[model samples]
Target: MLLLIAFEAAKSGLWPAISSALFGQRWGDNVVKGSVSALKNGPLCVLLNFPNLALPLMFVGIAAMRRLLGGPLAWAVGLMTAMYFLFAVRYSVSDQFMFFVPFYAMAAILAGLGFVRLSEAGKRRWLGVAAIILLAATPVTYSLLPSITQRFNIAVPGRTDLAYRDSPRYWLVPWKNNEDSAGMFARTAMEQVPPGSIVILDSTTFYAVDMIRRLEFSDKDVRLVILGKDSKMDAIPVGTPNVYLDSAGEGYHEKWMDEFATYDRPAGKALFLVVWKGR
Candidate 1:
């Protein structure tokens, strides 16, 4: 634990700035509420996030508890996994499901150790191999089936939008590219702006723009501004035409919308671009 303490101490100075940037003003309250919600949904979260590794993780738990897994290596892996899980539960942010990746990696390490132990069992080596195959195939099947069905235009029963939205298929399948539409919109919006024009982006638009800019617009000369909760419009230069790309429907930029005289407000969609005519 001395190592953990030293690590925390070394980065203690960065905590305040990081927390402020990520959580904003109500960081403490949001963290407490997020932790409580995460604790309540911990089991469901684990199952959804690590469906393929669930069985192997159970084996790891059983082996650890029975002292079948001993030594410093096992202890270190367990400790690190616990820490990752705790951090995953505590910090709630946009695309919160992605935060479980680190915890999943740690759990996979423990699960790998469990598999190794099972393989060492002379009589149960075949069982261990079967278990590994089953675990590996689960994720592969989940990912491939949807892609194939969608690709061939094969209409599978109960594969509607509602079903995907409510089921684990939504997370497992990479068929839908929601960011494509947003990136297209961002590209079109950027085209309307001149060189050195300031482009203000909401959280959702920020992610889409960041991805597409690295790929297609590396040479584009434009000033990018991220619209945060506490963003001040007064700081922007006067008489400079600016673009406000609001992709999220949460009304994060609603208060500042009145300042823009021209905008393309799309119907039935959250994406829109507002051109701010500077004073």
Candidate 2:
């Protein structure tokens, strides 16, 4: 906790903003209110997300009661797993899939402990070995096999369509899925902007393109500005070269299209760029 506070302080001196954002300010943003309806299916989500480890985790409960892996460690793992599971279930974030990462890690630890207990079964050692093989091979069969077959040009059933690549349903299934092409489109769009030109990104496009720019085009000379809904035209400098990248539908670009001499170009799927010729 102290290290985290020190790191945050060193990175940004605005402690109040940081605290507010973490505590409440940003909590309601992008939350899926209907998540309450899906609470009953939380266990199903866990099983589907962590297919390889779901069965093994059953042993964690047994270990916790029998103290197979020591009382403290077993109880600690079980308690942490339960806490994280509940948190993931209750958190109403739209991108709730990412929040399961810590839960997965803790569950993996408990699964490992379960495997250890199973392996020590004297007469049913074969059961332990079989469990280990299934646990290891489940991922290979479901995730890697599809990827490998596709790489070698081998035809396989249930291999077509990557639309779910970005969805949580395929989080553990495919090895290298390309369902979400937004990143590729974002990169292509960003490359068209000339060096030293200002790039304005709306709320939706800011996160999508900013990450790609930092990772792939960090050396490109461009000033990036985030244009929020309440931002004024004065936020942009007058008589300067600027490119506006945003979603195709009604947005800042559409609202101000009549105000400026603009050239619209389709950058990629559901994304477009507007070259602003200052009025």
Among all windows of ten consecutive residues in candidate 2, which has the lowest summed lDDT? 156-165
Question: What's the CA error at residue 267 for candidate 2, in Å?
Answer: 6.8
- For 1-279, candidate 2 gives per-residue lDDT tens digits of 235546776776668534533333456333334365346445545665566644555655455444766777666566666756666665565345565677777776666656666556552466656766877887666656445545787543221222112323234355546555557656765676778766666654567778888899899987667766423466554344555444434444535544664546542223344545544
C-alpha lDDT of candidate 1 relative to the true structure = 0.55
How many pairs of residues in model 2 come into backbone collision?
Answer: 0
Deviation in angstroms for 161 in model 1? 16
The reply for model 2, stretches above 4 Å from the true place, is: 1-45, 59-66, 69-75, 116-124, 141-183, 194-198, 202-221, 227-243, 248-270, 274-279
Give the alpha-carbon lDDT of every model: 0.55, 0.55
lDDT of 1 by residue, 1-279 (tens): 335455654667457544443344455555546755455545445665555645565466547633665677667666667666765666555445565676777766666666656656563666666767877787677677656656787544221221013233454454565424555556665555567666667665667666666677778886666776434556653344545445424444545555554555454333345655553
70 in model 1: Cα distance from truth in Å?
3.2
